[model samples]
Target: MNTPRLAHRPVPPHRPYRSKEFPVPDTQTQPLDPVALHRDSVVFNALDCTPLAWADETYLGKLAASGVTAINHAVSVSQGYDAAAAALVGWQHRLAETDGRVFQAYGLDDVTRAKETGTVAWFAGFEDSKPVGEDLWRLAALHQLGLRFMGLTYQNRNYAADGSGESANGGLSRFGRSLVAECNRLGIALDLSHTGERSTLETIETSTKPVLVTHAGLTHFVDSPRNKSDLVVRELAARGGVFGLAAKSGFLTPDGLTRRPGAEVFADNIDYLVELAGIDHVIVGTDVGDERKYSREGMARVRRLYPEIPIVGADLDLERIHPEGLGTPADLPLITELLAGRGYSGEDIGKVLGGNLQRVLAEIWDSASGE
Candidate 1:
């Protein structure tokens, strides 16, 4: 299989973490105050953050400010074997830098503790499982090192399977099948967010343990390659898997240029998935990291360099400053308010926030406890 040349948006260079911290852009949008409710709920922003390259007290403050109880932070992606290995090393160093201010969630107990203590419970995840390479044996070692969620592919084909960019839609490679079994045995949840349609559906059938498409749009809404088909979503829900909704402009809209549809569109997605796949299977995964605005020149440069993937974000216009609500971590509470307005009860809201993913985690992790 030919691995397509992927021109990806380069991660921006490190800068000083800004403060004065995002004042809610839409005060008149909702009457319900979700601060206390968000604090109480077990919020998990699946695959939201890119692991930091540098560490400091500012990083600590930004991490805490998300108000998210837990994050399946993608520490590794778009790297070869050596760089991927080093990514894990970097994550370990950052985790150590927290000095217990952050907690690692290996199981439910750790997650509960993080919720109770008001600390960020970060469970390590990778956007692609290519890091393990052909050494399926290494999965256990990485799991021991705190890797809990792993995607089979990211944007393009790997040794495991084809990603969305591949039109062939190949299922698991021989090694990919072995990988699925290893992940099931090791308690690493198989994340199929960027995986191709065939590979994702096949994995759903192959894995004994329930899987999760932790971050992607719904084809039922936008009919994009980056989103899942309705049939796939239904089958996943039937087999006890969870589907997490992502917060990306292109996947969410036609032109992929605005964030205004966030509240209504995201709420409608949750409701649609709930009706089709059931509420138990729907969850949250803002595929974006932090909300850092890019300059027009920066956006233009990205468009010029990576023509395949354009400025599918709010920063399409350099001078235009639109209200980016759910575009970042801070605007997450708006989800709660929107869901409430949609007539979701507290119990249902809890499940959508993190309870669904929480259940999937226990099922996978607890079963592999003896490992």
Candidate 2:
């Protein structure tokens, strides 16, 4: 069960922050034009666990207010098939009850409407494809339920493939190959975020349609087991696939330990990917979860363990939090502005925001329908 070790890249010299003491600016010196900033820029959220994170309707409303074009709702991961199916059913019920407020995207029209109205279009995606069971027919059933995208596995070995963090690091299983073909037939886009290296490469070679690594980072930047190699990034891009940059703090830094400065670090990752793979293949896929409930509980637990420094609620600043700016979904405009400041053109920004993902989705959906 020996996993292949990732080849290391020389760590870039850490850039000195403008102000290390204060990560976030207190006030905006120049106001960003919201309308102008949002123009041609479509935010494609690769992962959002808000539904599972918040009980308050206000939080959901906050997300809707964010002007996000689309979100890939993770329905299954680290859960059994039955549980995964149940989660999908529950999400569908929520969407129906919400009455298109959080509508499910089954085709291009759904995405079009999301752009026009500014409502969040939810695409059912399984964080792990373990729920497909041993039978390939289950893929069709899941697709009928609006499961458009699926990862082969989560952070462990499954029937289909081995995860990136798994010790075995096996390639796609026989059942995994069948599942990939079925996904091709059904028009589902295979995601290889948490999948092992061998499995990911094998999947890229096998799938008829383009694939997506919905949320991940470069192992060269951060030595985390979850991040992919630069070689894999190049291979995926060459195959017409999209590599969605994840927002997870650990995955983006070199040490995979300390939290790097928010927007700056995010920009660095973007620049790195653009250097390796063209700008057209890079997209933002923030795997941010709702921290409203968990933060307090986690803080309380931490206080019990280490009561030396009293960490109060005031110390929690969502604005400067994470290496990828945090302030619910509403803060996406800031990212666009940051990208622009980094000298990226409007077209490049658009591709990073949503165009890249749209291309892959359209390709996969068309292939599925043709079958």
Candidate 3:
């Protein structure tokens, strides 16, 4: 019988599936006593989530155990207004279902609240702006529904701008620029994570408030269409924005080594970003999670979007998405543990973990909270 095919088919270019891969440092299972530092520190994730099924109590338990203060949860995707509204409301209901363990975060204070109360703060974001459709007025209502940010594109062309893969790299459309102003006015942060480099830089130049590339890597490391260039990153820094270092191995390394990249590799990426962008501008935004089943389903869903190619990610099993050792929210302590071992000062480590995001959020959100 033909062997069952792997759910994630490998694509050309980075054949990471080849048995002989780059030699990674040994420490696949190295155990470390959990660091107590994160407990007191506000451990906010700029972008990432693999929240458990709402019905599962383990979801709430795992979050507390992981010490996650907040995350930019992707509650809606390329959806219509009604569907997106349902998602936004559903998330609020999820938090209520948790009986106050997780709270809806609208401002920097909400994050502080979560940190102090030992709960996870959920800041809702959209992976794309399609949910708003042609009507600019919809964004106002959506913002009221607790939608905090929206990516102009999902690495593909949209009404706002060209995604990473689009040949139309002409930057933001006229309507796109209009929406940017409205978002600035309405306190909805603009996330450039999945947008084209040209569009991203253009958005930065256009925005009055700081824009975020929530879960991205520098092209200086792994040069991919999805990664940002030095020019773009420098611009983002000069504008007082933050580049959230991602944990996905593909973004971390060009070889597509997400299968077994240890937490040390993630720490090294942090070090590089800090060197390039300085500590205050660098932060963690791991697009990872612990739940394998949900993650696999998430991948399949994304793949359907690009039926012609669906080449968003390297071909690897669902397990590679989170990487080994650094797989779940609970494993987050490992990064802090490694950072401490690397001689990072508590203040610096604290900034890398969440303090940086706190600062940016305050300026961007609070300054624009007028709307």
Top model number, lDDT: 1
Candidate lDDT values, in order: 0.72, 0.71, 0.71
lDDT of 1 by residue, 1-371 (tens): 43222222322222211112211223245444466556567788777655474345655666677678788878787676677667777877777878778766776677777877878888888889888888976777788778889988987889999887777888789999999998988899999988988888778878888899988878866776678988788767767788988766555555555534445767777788889887778887877565453456756765564343323553565322222466556667877878878887666677778888877777788898435
Q: How many backbone clashes does candidate 1 have?
A: 0
Query: lDDT tens string, model 3, 114-153?
Result: 7667778888888889887878889988888888867777
Each candidate structure's count of clashing pairs = 0, 0, 0
lDDT of 2: 0.71
Candidate 1 — what's its lDDT? 0.72
Tell me how far the alpha carbon of residue 350 in candidate 1 is from the true structure, in angstroms, after superposition. 0.4
For model 3, which pairs clash? none
